[model samples]
Target: MPKTLIVVYADGAAHPGDIAVGLASWARCVFVTEPADHTRAMEPLLSQFGPVITTGSAAEAAARLRPYVPDGLVTYSERALRFAAEVASALELPFHDRPTVGRLTDKWLQRDALRAAGVDTVRCHRIATENDWARAVADTGLPAVLKPAHGGGSRNTFLVTDVGEGLELVRGLLSEERPGLVAGGALVLEEYLPGRDLGPFGDYVSVESIVRQGQVTDIAVTGKFPMVPPFRETGRFWPSPLEYEEEERARELARRSVEALGVRSGLTHTEIKLTPDGPRLIEVNGRLGGGINELSVRALGLNLIELAGRTALGEAVPTPDFYRGRAYFQLFHPAPRRASTLLGIEGVEEVKRNAGVTLYRPYAKAGARLPGGVQTQELDIVMGEAPDVTELATIAKEVEATLRYRFAFADEPGAAVTESSVTGAELGAL
Candidate 1:
């Protein structure tokens, strides 16, 4: 029998269809989810690959997964990272090591670790309670970012332009209304890293890495389009548009940051911003960057998901040396902040008609409630391959322009009955 790998699965994560496809290239794969969220619908996608183990407690889950003799344990969700670490520990499997899990999951702790290791010296303060808001503001000051210390995918993340706005935002976070903010997770205020004017591209790029026994293998540098607002990313392209020197700086910083965080073995996504002063460290993610697998496979003939899974299985994966086939990219038009429910999406066929387009996956359909103001809450994803960055940009813009969205506004009195159609609205502003 081949080796088995236990994947800690959850909703708002790398899709099972994608995971199944990758794991099929290696050892048998089993998915384990907590009692809560959504494995039944995903089972059809994974049925051919392996079973999904859902249990009420960690101990029970460990017991269930133990019989598979899983050689590697992994999770791709920030919310599930710690839980996966615990289960990995229980199984005595190869993972990020139990002691260092906090630095991977908690934004504040992660920053502290980075700062301590001299990888990044970005100043930050933890807001433990509503009362701590002023002190946090004093520490990090205005014109900073305030976000849930344990959050990812931009949930409850905001820019604090003033002290009053900061206090009100903190209150909203500590209130019952923001359930997705991670229960009992303290907020962190950090100095905002201003970005340079990159013209057509976003100011930041991401470095995707696969690690084994603390050795880092950088696969690609992923570039971004300008964020919609506050900080909702719109899309990503492979073979970053950054200058060679800038790209090297990002990869080096990512290497240093990963080592600083004590990531023993796993896939890591380190986001770095190109600021006026120089390249600055953005947050580092312990899982595969969304869209990285697609970009890598299409543009470089690299199966990142497969490689990461193999790394988990104790395989000594090597650094990739590949010539690019083309520029591959993925884009999303996020739901506007005012959107409460999606009434319709139009022109998808037209978007498909665009040259170089490959896939159009809608995240929301008619009559579905819009997931509140987060970058992760996208209306749809448009994927394609272009001859170069210039061509990719043209296709991406055309695809985004061709589609239309009809939404019911959350704050409008008669939004329940009234549906409004618009190309899109800027996020982070209602």
Candidate 2:
């Protein structure tokens, strides 16, 4: 019998929709969705697959997909993870177990498991109330990391330097709107260990694998560009550059984490900081890494989404060998100011014309508003690939320097960048 693959996305509008397209090859059917703004560019390619059904709600979409009885289910966001599990259960399709999904989504729960396994990580505790907050401080001490116990892409993550900052951050989080997305309205605080920020120079290691029948397979390690965090991902590069010892430590950490979390199936994206203490497990997501995967999937010449589907569906995935080395992607944001229009992207053509640079994303439209809060993602002006870290960083700098944005309002036009503007510590964050 032909297999069916169902992909659940929050805002269905994904560019270069290869996941949907890839599943279409083997699946007997395919279904996808986005919220109100359905921006899935893969819709055009859906016809090549089986019937494509678009819906408003995952439940509604899942109901529509019921007849197909999909063999596999996969998703990107937490919302979609819940919906995918629901659809899998409704149709009895193979999927990541409920417990596994919970462990993956809930940060505190995952940390508890890691702690139990004696995993070396930053010290952390959960805060359920005012009392819990106070207790957490006493336990972990001041100048720690605070983030929603169950959140992603560094949403509401704060690095509190002192007690006052911690108190205010907690108060703001508590008072702020609760989307009720996760199970609890709790906060997770951890001892903040200062380290070299990995986003700028070092590779963001993504150890990818497909787990099936309580076993993992098809593991692939890739490198990524340094992320400007709290939810900004510039791009990724394949074949991470790691010292022999560090790479081994990361592999061991990833292996232990998968075992500790009891991840039976699906792809897991783990982010860790290589601290002096060793490979400190930052956090693990039991799914493909967004934006990062965009480059890996292309560079590695592999179909991660498809491999994940096969694992979820209890099917065998084709053997995957790491592809050509040294592929990179960059995300360009309004670094100093909100660029309203392209006043000039100086070396864009030169870079494009260069042999090694592969692809580009003109995230902002010509007349689009300048970037600030919500339009931050759109503020990214360019994305392209290079050969190695040196080339990648050089091109990234070149691309950053070339792009010029015409601001909507004329306050001072731009923020002055000083030596202090990008201090040693600040560079780590970039």
Candidate 3:
């Protein structure tokens, strides 16, 4: 019988489509997801690969998955990481141990461990009350960041330029109902590190790696597009345009940061800021970088999800020569205004006709409600490949110039169409 792999599925999981394809190629794939997800779009898409099991809770999912005696267990959800770690432990399977997963998932714990290990990291404090928030500001000084201690997608993250803003944001967070991954009323306040003042690409970048048996192999450095501020990512460019020495320094920092966190085996994504002083860790993720799998496959000629699955199954992972090319993924957001309905998209055909264009996917449906001011909830994504950074920049500009979005508000009868212009310089390609 073929080996069995159990995947904990969630909406917005890192590379779910690619992960399913990767696992199904090597093992008998079984997906465990929420019942609601099963009834939604994910079910049909995932059903193409293998059987899916719907459960109400993580514990119940584990109970159902136990009988399978899965050879490997994996999850791309930040909320599911701890649960998956527990299930893996019960099954005696290879995984980043529970403690390691905790440190990776909890931003506060991550800061503590990295600092304790003498890793270069910013000072951060946990806030659960107004008093704690004031104390954090007094200690960390002005221009700090306020964010959930265990949150992803930049939800509820805010940049506190002053005490009043910080206090308001913290009070709101304290009163809001907490997500499963977050401790009730808990938030993290950290000293903000400014990135290089280059255009859209911030001074920070993400390092993607696959770790096996306590060894980490750095695979790629991904550059970021200028954020929506208060800390939401807009897009990313792969094989960062960093010079050889800077790239090496980043790799060393990533390896050290991962080692400090005690990650044994899994895919790791580490974000670090290229500060004027040096590289400092932002956070570490115990899975592939979100939206990076497809970019990796296109630029490096590697399937990160497959590599992660093979590592989980205790199989030898082969390191292949990466393709010497550049690729970028940009997000389109309904910013400046919210839309009650997405009427249509124009110039998609022209974008597809561009030589460098590879993938263009729109997430918004005709009747979908699009909330403004959040880049993380972008309505569409465009990815392309080119022989070098220059060509990649050209492609990005062309796509941005060609595509247009038409939206209608509840009070409006006619759709409002607008063309978005994004220049290469504004994209911040290093």
Candidate 4:
């Protein structure tokens, strides 16, 4: 039977058209869906592949995937990654080790595994009750971070500096509804280390290789931009901007963590933080890059999608190099307003006229109330590539300023968008 590539994802604010594009580039057939949007973004791209199947969710699409595709691989999205692993196991197809994937996804379990393997990491503990939380707080101390044991995207993350705050946070956490998590068994509490929040925080390297006869082959690194706290990734920059010495140090530490974790083949998106002391583990996702991988494909000039397909098929792989110069991504963040309608772009002509900006797009439409809180919004994303960060930042600010949305609060007297609290009125998230 011929091989097929399957990618799974949950419907949400934004459709991962980039993931669909990557899968379509390599697989004989591609499938993707966005249940919430009641929309599918891959109808055009999937045409190149043999057959493109669109359904409501990853699980629904999994049923339509042909058994002929003997193997599969998953990229960044947490829901898609786990669903792919489960689907692979059910189909009796070669897939990543379930235990390893579990450890990678759960923060507390990951710390335990690393400690057992003699890998250095921050102190962490798991709790499911008031008694457990108290014990964990005593052991880890005040100024701690609380997170769902198996959560992603920083949905319910809380930072507490004292026991009282911790208690309040715990109460709030217990009260809030979390819909995506399957295992409600545990919550993780860890010592919160205060330092610079690297956007993307660390490099999300997607090492692609084959484990043949117990030998590892093929490895590639995809550098990521520092991310904002609680899993909101601003963007990814390839070939890390670290000095040569720092870069070497980071690579060695990454190698140690990878070997310690026993990752033999496939792609791994590992995050490591450089502290005043040294590098500490920040969890690793056993999959290809999310936005970083896409930047890598363009910057590194590698066919990662195809490479992953070959590896899944048990084929040999080749080493790849980084793109010349630098490639940076500026994630669009809502400037700072609510209930805003995209009034249409104002300075687009001027922005497009500027050099170094390769692409411009607004993922949200007009008349949509911008979702508040530290979450992703379609209006917040404008992807562009440039030779360096300085140029990228300049162009990003210009584009951000140029793109305007009109917002009118229901309680306000008139249809006014300006704010009287601060200097100038704005409608967006920054």
- Best-performing candidate as measured by TM-score: 1
Those runs of model 2 whose alpha carbons end farther than 4 Å from true positions after fitting are: 12-16, 32-64, 179-184, 197-200, 229-231, 322-324, 334-347, 370-378, 381-387, 406-430
Candidate RMSDs in Å, in order, are 2.4, 4.9, 3.9, 5.1
lDDT of each: 0.79, 0.62, 0.74, 0.55
lDDT of 4 by residue, 1-430 (tens): 4456655445321234555455554455445444433334445543545455555444555566654454654434565555666666666656666776677666777788788878766789887665677888888887887877876555666666778777766666655565225544467888766544344234333333334323444343444444444444545555554555655555566555656666656666666665655555666665554555556566666655556556665767665643436755645444232444444445545656667666566665545654444443435455567776566656655665665555434434475455222111133223
Number of clashes found in candidate 1: 0
Clash pairs, model 1 backbone? none
Tens digit of per-residue lDDT, candidate 3, span 1-430: 8788888777557545677666776688888776554336688777788778776565666677777778887777776787677666766777878789889988889999988999875889888688897779877787888888888877777778978877887877788787324558488999998776655356888898888889888888887766655566667887676777887798899999999999988889999898877778889999877878877766666778878877888889787553335555554543323344566667788888888877778877655666653335666777776776666666766776677665555435464554343332232111
- Pairing residues by index, what is the TM-score of model 3? 0.87
TM-score for all predictions? 0.92, 0.80, 0.87, 0.76
- In model 1, what lDDT does residue 139 have? 78
lDDT, candidate 1, equals 0.79
TM-score ranking of the models: 1, 3, 2, 4
lDDT of 3 at 70: 80
